[model samples]
Target chain A: MKTPWNRFDFLLLPLLGGAFILLLWHLSSHSWSGDLPDPAKTWHESKPYVLEPWAKRGELDQGILRFTFLSLILVAKGYAIALILGTPIGFFLGLSPTFNKAFDPIIQILRPVSPLAWLPLGMVLFAKIKGINVTEVAALFTIALCSMWPTVLNTAVGVRAIPTDYLNVARVLKLSRWKTLTKVMIPATLPYMFTGFRLSLGIAWLVIVAAEMLTGRPGVGGFLWQQYNALVYEQIILCILTIGGVGFILDRLMSVIERRFKTI
Target chain B: MSAHLELFNLTKVYPSKKGPQTIVRDFNLQIPKGEFVSIIGHSGCGKSTVLMMVAGLTTVTSGGIILAGRELSGPGPDRGIVFQSPSLLPWMTARENVMLGINQVFFTATEQERAQIAEYYLSVVGLADFMDKRPAELSQGMRQRVGIARAFALKPKMLLLDEPFGMLDSLTRYELQQVLIDLWRRNQITTVMVTHDVDEALYLSDRVVCMTDGPEAGIGEILNVPLPRPRDRKAILELPEYHRLRATLIEFLEVRAHHRPNSSNSPSGAATPPASVPVSA
Candidate 1:
């Protein structure tokens, strides 16, 4: 019962759709002929930047690779902080109805606030805190805070959704609290926690870019803003493509890790 | 012989918006060691509630459950329970699911010995080939077999089953019933099963305890199955007593169903039987 769409068809369809869009963009640029840079012109202008991605010119003129690596570092730090803090808090909220009731309103109020809203507060708070530069600390804090919600909420939901039957099995076995937490709660909630992690990672990446752009930091978002200030449309287009491509790879990597955990 | 398991005037009351509603009333049952007892009643009859109380999974509002010489406090390793849903941890393999209980109960056993015990029980349930498979990869019957293997691996003093095959098709149910009977006969573990199937009750249990419907459901009758040992399904059906017992149980249920008030189906309505009848057998 093979359908018309085979594996090759599945791969070809999306590629064809992307090619069609590129063709349309090329035609529309030629026809309009305005401030928009033509595809050929942008490609020619950005060819050196693409080929020498890892070249170091200066702090602001760092290669695209350096900008990408810097952005990744910020994402990793913020996402790691969120993971370390959010997981246990989520488990606490899930396991205790009283805690959930007391804190749910606060989480609801704070979760939907824009990441940008925290920049000024974070800057002020981190200014006198210690070793790290105020702007960098504020950028990291904003990214971590904004990305923390999904992991917390999703982990709590996952823990709460554990089948009562599994808990009953834990009781019948008279498993120690620690054993139950590790064997039953953690494994049962892993999938949901990973879902939260995936979403949180995405948020971390998105927020880091915005945070870096506002803070005038050395990252992809900052590079894009700098290019925009200089009115270099070609570099801006290149940054957009690089950011999208990195985000796609990060999501795919998370999926691979998720599948590995699932099989166990 | 003295009772190995006893439920003394056990009762359960669940609080509602209206008031406290009693699901079980003055429930009394005693099972001697190594006896297989099946509790059968219509749906919403509180049979499962009674089993849960005995397993110490539910709070007993007014009575106590006694296992051996001690008063039951809460769920412990001494009583192994198999739920209607297989309830295996989907993430783990069949072998690991069974080993979970074995590791808890037999913590002192060496790793190899514990693994052997898990493998032994899984083999008993005809799941040797599927030991490494996850629950999702196996059929419903196989998953329940893994649950049975897990409970048996604990080597508990008592085994509690709440409609272990209620979700299976007829063929699978029959097959699993045979497997359970074989396991029970070999181990001679004290077992109490809650089910609504009369044939299933007669086939597997030494005694079948029937209950009136809820709310405030109580034990209606306890019938001793006089069928000989090593009973075969085909052979048991041929016996005259088999037909008599089936008819008697169905008649009691039919009478109750007819006299039940239309409102009795409500979650909190008390089931008032038109008349109380004595057990004929």
Candidate 2:
């Protein structure tokens, strides 16, 4: 009976707030509906899509869990490749002013283009060169293209911000160029590199959804689109909710990682 | 090896819109063995410029800088420099920063040897308890102590400092100055420091090189500090010669301060003195 804002009473607010929202949704679902489903009906109807994605395909080759796992793996692969290739290039670009100026216009023009635009080109190039199906390789390339921009840009900015006085210390100590770059430069730029990493993950997630939708892959986006077309309104809502929930989870996971490294 | 640092007619110039502005001109000095020389001047008198030139961070326009009887082409481990700022790597622990100098200068040493040297110097500066702490965790005075410890850990032929305690409060500066004097005496490391504090120069240095203001800055005079070893602070403050030398340095600085702004403004190319006054004979 205490006020909800009190310290011990605070725990009940979220539960009550959720029930209030659902009750309003239930009321509104019947307010003006010829085809609208209530929250209870939607939860029941969408349960299968969560529990069993394989039923739609007429085979058990892939399911919701399988597709989700595959997409996560692809994102990881693309990010790993980007990290290896982009960091060195970023370091070099950030260290030299002349090179930075020379390459800046190209980076500026290229960074803002949509990752989807590269999907068609990536499919063709990978299909012709690697003899692999276009969809799998195209998704990764598109993710890489999108995520590489922030990673490279942030790493370069961090490298450039290293104080000149630190460089003098390294020089007076006669630290070798390799030691200077590895021990001093890399550690100093680690925070910026992580910033790039977080940005790349967000970009990767965005591009993966788009790429799956474009390629008609058996993933969450494709399932969502298919459910919408089938006019299974309850299932469609569930699929949309699931996508948002997973994205939120991924972002939270990234924040945890960012927090751990933020001190550096 | 005995330290023999000599600046043979050292000069420095900065490019200006009109032409070139000279900072230090025809400045000649020599430090034999373990002399602790402090260069004192008002701001804009190119005192720090001289230190930078000696450290090989600044280019010498027309003179030679010799360290331990060898011409210095660039910065080397033979001369370690502690700057006004600690300049410790933010990510590194105090121990790591000190070890950076030790390892780089003595690459052939064993890991234990390197670590021991770093620890010994940290202990010398009374920072052994905070060895594992990062630069951010330490206070300003503590960080400067690490800077000093890092410089001395190299066991270099000479040490160059640029107003290393200029940023600290009076109490902290005085405390660190005493620590520095003790360390320099114990190690017998030849030292050159540039500062604007007359009392600091008087207290810490074997000789104080007072500089005049520039476009063409030159050494005003070198005052030989005759205070006995392990100097008593209160007793030195009471000495008449100490007050007399402090007055002479202050008066020389006041005259130079009035002329520096004029030279600084009159385009770099035009080198004109402002009502030139003769140095006391």
What are the clashing pairs of model 2? B19-B269
Please tell me which predicted candidate would have the highest TM-score against the true structure.
1
Per-residue alpha-carbon lDDT of candidate 2 for residues B1-281, written as tens digits (9 for 90 to 100): 34498888998988988687787888889888899999988787788899988888888999998887789887877887899999999888999999888878888999999999999989889898999999989999999999999998888899999999999998999889988999999999889999999998989889999887765777777889988878878889998989998898888677644343333343333356334433221
Runs with alpha carbons beyond 4 Å of true place in candidate 1: A1-33, B256-281
Q: What lDDT is reached at residue B152 by model 2?
A: 89
Query: What's model 1's overall lDDT?
Result: 0.87
lDDT of each residue in B79-146, candidate 1, tens digit only: 87889999998888999898888988899999999999999999999998999999999999999999
- Would you list the C-alpha lDDT of every candidate in the order shown? 0.87, 0.82
TM-score of each: 0.91, 0.89
TM-score of 2: 0.89
TM-score of 1: 0.91
Estimate, for each residue in A1-264, the C-alpha lDDT of model 2 and write its tens digit: 556467755677788898998898788888866476788999787666567754545322245665666667877888788778778879889999898999889989988889779888888888876567778888888888878988899999999987888888888888899999987888888888888888888888777778877787766666666666678778656656766776788888877887777665
Which interface RMSD values do the candidates have, in the order shown? 2.1, 1.4
C-alpha displacement of B209 in model 2, angstroms?
1.4
Candidate 2 runs further than 4 Å off: A1-38, A51-63, B1-3, B16-19, B257-268, B271-281
By lDDT, the best candidate is: 1
Measured by DockQ, the strongest candidate is 1
